[model samples]
Target: MNPLISNALKKDLELYFSEDDLSRNLYYTASLPHDLVDCKLKLKDDLLLAGLPYFVEAFRYLGDTSLDWDYFKKFEGKTYKKDEKAEIHFQLPFAIALTGERIALNLLQHASSIATYTSKFAARAKDKGIAILDTRKTTPGHRSLEKYAVRVGGGYNHRLGQTDLWMIKDNHKSFFGGVKEAVEFFRSMKGFYTPIEVEVHNMSELEEVLSLGIRHIMLDNFSPEEVKRAVKLKPVGVSFEVSGGIRLSNLDDYLIKGLDAISVGALTNGAPNVDISLKYNR
Candidate 1:
């Protein structure tokens, strides 16, 4: 597993156990047998599968370490139709399966939803040679898994965190008085060299950043026409990305030819969870 995912899974499991109370399986402890049992996950809604690794890991973390997962491994990233049944199967102790079910289903449903939604935007952007990127607007404690789903759905990830990229947004520009001052300050820091992406709110700011030799730029909240005009002014070797207010409904309007990427926060923030359920095989 990726380190980011591993770390996230650890934190998520810790929280899950804490909130759900590890010692309480009420009915399972009261009367149900703790014997190993076969189980199948029912896909009640059509969705592109994602987070199987996280789902599997949840069980592993909960002490179902010897599970035979070859059956379900093949389904990751594959789309399944609604009411699909018997495709995903596994076995674990009844208590462990019941304990891990919610966490597993939550991860799978949420990640699959993001992945499914992202695929739509990614497909449209691919036609125009533009990459669909996910922003930092992700669920708390699920950034790694959510970003992973974005990739599974064929979209690219922007900065995972502040450290991944040096993005000078409008606030930074405002605080430093202008783009030039902000860029200079970042450039002057010794041993702090990293790829810098500056967000320009208008053509004037774009020109100022361009004049300073900054190649990576984000046209924050620019409309289709405005973006086209900015692209026309784009110099050779400069990459332009647009973010803010871009959505599936108006995605086509922003698929300008010269734009390199279109970052949408909704990919993670607005995606609804796909429905899924776990049923024991009696």
Candidate 2:
């Protein structure tokens, strides 16, 4: 596991095990059915496998480490069609395994959903070399895991936080008075040399931002023809990204020559959950 992810997973697991909270399985765990048992995981719907590492860690926390929990995860990040199954052999007190099932399954389902949605978009740009990026529009606490799932599906992650990049959005312009005014304040602040991206709502905004000599520009809600025109207007080495209201079916239409990337907000914000269930051996 990546050290960063391992560390973050540890912190997230702490929240699950919080003493001050009885939210997850704290109430049930108090009365464990003290006998060993085995279980398997089965899929009801098709999806890209994800969150196996997290799933493994979740069980690691619930079951005794000395016991045999020989879990073989060869399908994570790969597609699993309907009716597929993966067997896991773990010897844990019946209640210990049962109590942690919901939390563990919730994480796996959510991550698999995001990965599946991202894979559709990522596949569109694979041959073109154009990038597919996930927006910061993600579930509040699940951003890190959600973004990690995006990568699992072959998509690239955008800014992890506000500090990673400098972005000038329409609201930032409204708050700071105008596009140029916001740009000036951002420039005079004297911070790290982060990639500066400005969102352009129309041709005027696009031209205005272009005159500022910014390397990266986002064509927010622009039509395909308009994006084609904007692509022509951009100078050499300028990176152009189109965002807003793009769907998997129509994404290919937007990939014209010179277009650098497309940003999809739905990758994390609105992906549907993948259906999976845990089965215990009788």
Candidate 3:
């Protein structure tokens, strides 16, 4: 399993079981005639399936050691229509399935939702040779899973975490006196070769950073017309991205030529979970 997935799952399990008290389930454990049962994982809505690994891992983590791993692996990243009634059948201990259902579905639904939402933007961006990117505005502990879902939906990730790239945003520029100072400070550091990206809020800021020789730039909240102008000013090999106030509705307005990518925070933050559920097969 991916270490990030494992770590997040561990934290989720600890938080959930800590509050719910697993022993309560054990109260009826002895009365149940069967320890293991067949089950169906059903989709209640159309969705691009993601995080099957996490869902399966959740059951394994909860001691469902005999799960049908091969059966689940085939469905990852598959898109299913609501009317099709996508159903995944497997068998696991009844108590373990019940205990891990929500955790499993939570991770699955959240990831699938992000993937589904991102696909819309990605499909639109792809037509213009532009890439759709996801922002750092993800659930605190679920960054890894969320970013994974973004990729599954055809979107690229900007920076997995702060250290992945050196980004000088408005706040960083304000504290460091200006964009030049902030850019130079990082540039001056010995062996700090992480690619630098600066968020420029206006044309002036754009020109200043352009002179600083920053290769990657994000035009913060720039309109389509403004982005077209910024693109004209962009030197050869410099990449321009747009962020802020971007959504599916207004996405086309910003798909101007020369724009390298569009980063949408709503991919993870605003996406509603795709409906899914797990139930006994009876």
**Residue 253 of candidate 1: its Cα lDDT?**
97
TM-score of 3: 0.91
| TM-score for each of the candidates | 0.91, 0.89, 0.91
The CA lDDT at 72 in model 3 is 75
- In model 3, what are the clashing residue pairs, if there are any? none
Candidate 2 residue pairs that clash: none
Worst lDDT window (10 residues) for model 2? 63-72
Which regions of candidate 3 deviate over 4 angstroms? 1-34
Report the candidate with higher TM-score, 1 versus 2.
Answer: 1
Q: What's the CA error at residue 182 for candidate 1, in Å?
A: 1.1
Between prediction 2 and prediction 3, which has the larger TM-score?
Answer: 3
Tens digits of lDDT, candidate 2, 1-282: 344644668878767656425457556657667676767777777789888877767666664453332344565777877865644355556765676677788888889999998998888788887889999998877887888899999999888998687889999999999999988878876776877889999999989999998889999999999998888898998999999999887998987888888999999987878888887753
Give lDDT tens digits, candidate 1, residues 180-265: 88888777664265788899999988988889899899999998999999999988899999999988999999999899999999
TM-score of 1: 0.91
Write model 3 residue lDDT over 1-282, tens digit each, in one string: 555655666766566456566677676755544467888889989889998878888877876667665677789888899999989888877767777788888889999999999998998989899999999998877887899999999999999988788889988888999999999877776536789999999999999999988999999999888998999998999999999999999999998989999999999999877899888844
Highest lDDT scorer: 3
What global local distance difference test value does model 3 have? 0.86
